[model samples]
Target: MSMADLVRAGAPELPEGYFYRVRSTNIRSLKVEIREQRRFRSRLVADTWVFERPDESAEESIVKACDRAFKGWQEADAVRASYLAVTAYLGDHDPKGGR
Candidate 1:
């Protein structure tokens, strides 16, 4: 699937003012930035995914960058979900996973 399609399917409800763009990509690096809550206090978070792209065209670079960004977002979401689950399991408990 395309990067856009993957992001849309995964993050159906994006924060207000959330936006993503390919920042730069070359034979050595791919970079993308995701901006969220840009109304008054905007936050810009960038993630870079690198891979060898020798002989790749600009269009190919862009597509790869977008894909990397999408993957990074997905990985971040998974980590967050796991953390929440652990937190919930811990709750107001002691060392044990209980209240």
Candidate 2:
């Protein structure tokens, strides 16, 4: 199965206005089309998942984002270590093998 499919399968069911996309390698794009939600009383909110490398594409970006978010949430005090762990995981599991 593709990385996108895996991500979609694993992702939590978001609200009506929330949407996510995995582009190429390092550009996981998130689009929240909600009117307002509690403190975030805004019309729309767009967020980008960016990695340390500029050459990475959408899929890579999504993986990195997932890694960072998951690790960060799991270990708030060890954010740097978690980030490195995620990077290493991506490097080892990259389907293209850094091609």
For lDDT, the strongest prediction is 1
TM-score, one value per model: 0.56, 0.30
Tens-digit per-residue lDDT, 3-96, candidate 2: 3463564533334543344334434434212122445544433333445457876555555565544444336537767788878655356667
TM-score of 2: 0.30
Candidate 1 per-residue lDDT, tens place, 1-99, comes to 443553554423344566655544555555566657655775765465544467885555555665566567778889999998888765355667545
**What TM-score would you give candidate 1 relative to the actual structure?**
0.56
What lDDT is obtained when candidate 2 is compared to the true structure?
A: 0.46
lDDT of each: 0.58, 0.46
Model 1 residue 10 CA deviation (Å) reads 16
Query: What C-alpha lDDT does candidate 1 achieve relative to the native structure?
Result: 0.58
